[model samples]
Target: MGTFKIEGGHQLKGSIQPQGAKNEALQILCAVLLTPEKVTINNIPDIVDVNKLIKLLEKLGVKIEKLSKSTYTFQADEVNLQYLESDQFKIDGRGLRGSIMIVGPLLARFGKGYIPKPGGDKIGRRRLDTHFEGLIKLGAKFGYSREEQFYGVEAKKLKGTYMLLEEASVTGTANIVMAAVLAEGQTTIYNAACEPYLQQLCKMLNRMGAKISGVGSNMLIIEGVDSLGGTEHTMLPDMIEIGSWIGLAAMTKSELTITNVSWNDLGIIPSVFRKLGITVEKRNDDIYIPAHTDGYEIQSFIDGSILTIADAPWPGFTPDLLSIILVVATQARGSVLIHQKMFESRLFFVDKLIDMGAKIILCDPHRATVIGHDFKSTLKATTMTSPDIRAGVSLLIAALSAKGTSTIMNIEQIDRGYENIDERLRAIGAKIERLD
Candidate 1:
């Protein structure tokens, strides 16, 4: 249980660079197993979850080399497929939710894939049905070990076909696409998640000799290839962290610049922040946010109704950043309803904010209406436990804006996603220290 001790009411300044996308790294790392050739990747964020995944790969016998601080080359020329049947493999595969992805490539090339039920943020129930169902449609046999709590998918040779995903899941789509890339025939996926993470995966797979079309849309078509080859790729800066930084600047009344944000890949994140009355200035590829000394206001809909910030699929505001948006709204001039449609318990963290004096009503499991103090009342410091990755960062943002000292426990949840968050925040004048 790690802890973050923060001194509140402090201002932050200076420019910070967003880390390479964590979500993208998960999918991209797993794709390395698709080929036996050396694949070099740059801008891999050094976070706990990613490190754990890399270690799991090492255990499974992928040759990995750290060429630079944020770059690595991987070769699966002699991967130990037998490791997948070992108890150690079950422990390793259960370490992170992203471990579920390795199944796709393994099933495609080696005819089998097995993993212990994966683990991750406890925000909601993330079903693996999407991955298995899509793979089944491609002619893979799905199995489960009820007693051991394991999942298995195997196919001598996957035969791609049409699949309309029950839901547009990012990892699900990535898994299906990776399997389809080596299948026997054409595979069409409709209602696929087209998040930048998925798009990056598709483009990287293409570079590795896979044929995938519809890079940024809900529909994808993959033409099976015999095998993939090596390729070099770079990751986009994390948009979720960019959104968190923007919210932090407004909440702490600080002037901050987020550099190399890959503005084109950020989708509706900037405009969504703007709707909350924050000045999101675009200076080339960097995002410059000025101090909100005068406080910002929430903008109502054109029909004068209360603004509702809801999470939708790509080209819409992401659910991952809704917690940050809700926290930033605590000091805004008006009220807003945050609809976290994707996850049920994500709004449960609002009770911690209420304890700190922000006026918020948990309307339901999926929606919360927040009434902003507009900087009129300072949130009082409180001790709290981080619930999940997004919620943990949201609490951190709240602690930064509150009056007096605050302590946040279970900070490992925060580290799982954000890379050296406290160190990065401290560089910009944040009064935060890690308590070991």
Candidate 2:
């Protein structure tokens, strides 16, 4: 239960670089199991989740070397399959949600894979049906232990086949794609997730000798190969963190530059903020957010209806960012409805915002209506506890813009996703301190 003590109402300046995409790193790291040759990955984020995954891989006997701060070389030639069945593995694998991805590659190359029920955010019910079903479609045998809450998949040889996914789940698509790459025949996947991070995974796998087409679309075609070779890959910048910085700049009236954001990959995130009347400018591969001297205003629909920002699949606004958007709307000039359609409990943190004197109506577990104060009534600092990763950062942003000192507990939630957030915030002149 770490805490953050923030002195609010401080203006920030300077440029901050976004960390490598954590989701992409998770998928790419798991792919190392597909090959025995050395694979070098650059731009890996140093967040808690990613570091934990790296430790898990090291325990499995992968030869890992640190080339630099964000670079690593991995060789899976000496992987220990016996460790997967150990009690220690059950504890390590179940501690992180990303552990579920390891099952795909392990089942493909090693004939079998097992994992305990993976754990992560407790925002809502995140079922593993998509992952298991996709593998089963690719001719892998699935078994579950109800009492132990463990999952296992086995296949002497996977046979690729055409199948349509029930939902365009990103991790599910990645899992199925990984297995199919080593199958016996051609495989076609429909309704596959086409998020930029998923596309990165497919591209990386292709670089490692997998035949995958439809790189940026919902449909994927894979031609199975006997084995994969090593490849060098780099991760994209974290768009969710980029979006968070944008919201933070607007809330605190900071002129901030987010460099190397990979503009083409940020699909519609900028325009979504523009809809909230925040100025998001493009200055060559970087995002430049000028201080909001005059508070921003929310835009209404052309038909004179209240504006609603909701989450959907790829190319749509991401659910991970709805919390930051909702927090930014607190000081804007108008009202907007934030609909977190993906998870039921993500919007529950709005009560803490309301406690800080922001005008918000919690319509339900997934909906909230925020009436901006237009900077006329600044939020008063209040003590709060972080419920999750995104919500924790939102609270931190609110504290930075409030009038008095604020305290936030459970900062480990924030640390799970963001790398060295307090240090990064300090580099941008933010008044924050960590209380151990």
In candidate 1, which residue ranges exceed 4 Å CA deviation?
Answer: none
lDDT: worst 10-residue window of model 1: 86-95
- Where does candidate 2 clash, by residue pair? none
Which residue runs of candidate 2 sit more than 4 Å off their true CA positions? none
TM-score of each model, paired residue for residue: 0.99, 0.99
lDDT by residue for model 2 (288-317), tens:
999999889999999989999999999888
The all-Cα superposition gives candidate 1 an RMSD in Å to the true structure of 0.6
lDDT of each: 0.95, 0.94
Q: In terms of TM-score, how similar is model 1 to the real structure? A: 0.99
Residues 21-137 of candidate 1: C-alpha lDDT, one tens digit per residue:
999999999999999999999999999999999999998899999999999999999999889999999888888999999999999999998999999999888999999999999
State residue 273's C-alpha deviation in candidate 1, in Å. 0.5
